[model samples]
Target: MDNSAQAPLQTAEDPLFIGGVGLKSRLFLGTGKLGREELIPEIVAAAGVQVITVALRRVDLSDKSGNVLSHIPVHVQLLPNTSGARTAEEAVRIARLARACGTGNWIKIEVINDSVNLLPDGYGTAKATEILAKEGFVVLPYINPDLYVARDLVNAGAAAVMPLGAPIGSNRGLRTKEMIRILIEEIDLPIIVDAGLGVPSHACEAMEMGAAACLINTAIATASDPVHMAEAFGLAVAAGRAALLAGPGRSLVAGASASSPETGKLTAFLEANAASG
Candidate 1:
């Protein structure tokens, strides 16, 4: 099978390198909360996503028809996440299991015990990252937008730091924008804005703010039309990335700035005509 068709084409923008792998697409999709599992391939094709995250629990290898792995194309990189893990130990176990299942070495460390908020446990996450990274796993830990925790993850050898835009599955959209901005500026690793992105504009804003990528699942899955929403997100991500590369104009602090030059020939002519009149 020619799976090369499944890979997203590289754009004019530079590739996003993580764990020494160059990814063309900045939009990373998640295979959770989808109305139909069969839509995975279609969503990937629509979004042109190079990386797709899947919960370890969803991989049912025994049943080929139901297996999430079966639906995913070989060209796309699989990022198996430790979703149900509540502690560092459990997260390590899940990651190890994922690798054992031949899902590759890339793992998204998610240690969340809080059922109410569904927020990641930073301490546990860092610890797991440290362990998994040592074991040769490409670790991407999902965390709160905390500078200290990010620093810890860096020291722990994380390939990238994934901070939440808001509470998981809330679709609130970059509620922690300032904090994420801080991480982007401070952290040396790629800052992938994960969770709570409700719309294409939210993804665009994140990219404009210099986020390396955006991981969206719930918004696209629960939307009225998942495929269309995926394509919208894909375009939005590309546009935002291009805008960032283009070097957006600086914002004024108080007064509005005129688009036309203040001291140009046209301006002088207009001023003279007004004065003469």
Candidate 2:
């Protein structure tokens, strides 16, 4: 029953906060390309996801059994995305329709005009985000890992900036890692790495690099065992987050560093023994 709209902005225990809601889980699961609609609840529970993204086109209000909304628990925050919209105008229209369906105000702006690459149009996304944000919707726009576009979204009143790790559903695993790192460093808002994550390691890498969150779909849904995959992703996300919080040691550029002391009594004893032999 706890939705983003009603949830508090911050809590003592919860660290990941988006759209005025504190989420314990950093992974956001997508409903599209799922193998079975019936596995939705189990997938969600297995992943321990607090937010699930559903395409507006996939929701059927009339067919109760087929409706994606029916399978989702009321407690989870619904992130209705404009997946099929090819233009800003079309995206805006879909967002309004999604709201009318009582799915909540969280909208993921996906304006992809490039049919070949399926990359989002940055200009159109910014326009739609500005329009929707003013309308009191929590706008999370998906874009190629571009610094300027991310800045534009921030100025346009976006809740968080979602930069794709690679092409949508490619499962390529952080091809744009450097650019995404720049966004995470410079952007004041939460930089959620979305799209093209292939495995649990990909999600883990994103979290390790200080990404506020990650949204994955194809990798989990198309796996041999979806429930187990979801669980793996959940554990991976948590482990990466904990590692980040624990402050991993700096990586050396050339020379290797030993875990134990290099110039200690043990090293001296070993050297003496070797010399005597």
For candidate 1, write residues 1-277 as lDDT tens digits. 2334544433634789998887888999987988587888888888888899988775467775677778887788899999999999999999999999886899999999999999999999999999999999999999999999999999999999999999989999999999999999999999999999999999999999999999999999899889889999999888898899899887785534466454365456777789667
**TM-score for all predictions?**
0.87, 0.85
Cα lDDT tens digits for candidate 2, 65-151: 677778888789899999999999999999999999886899999999888999999999999999999999999999999999999
Give every collision pair in model 1: none
CA RMSD per model (angstroms) = 6.7, 7.7
Candidate 2: stretches off by over 4 Å: 1-12, 58-65, 253-277
Kindly give the stretch of ten consecutive residues in candidate 1 with the minimal lDDT sum. Answer: 1-10
Best by TM-score: 1
User: In order, how many clashes per candidate?
Assistant: 0, 1
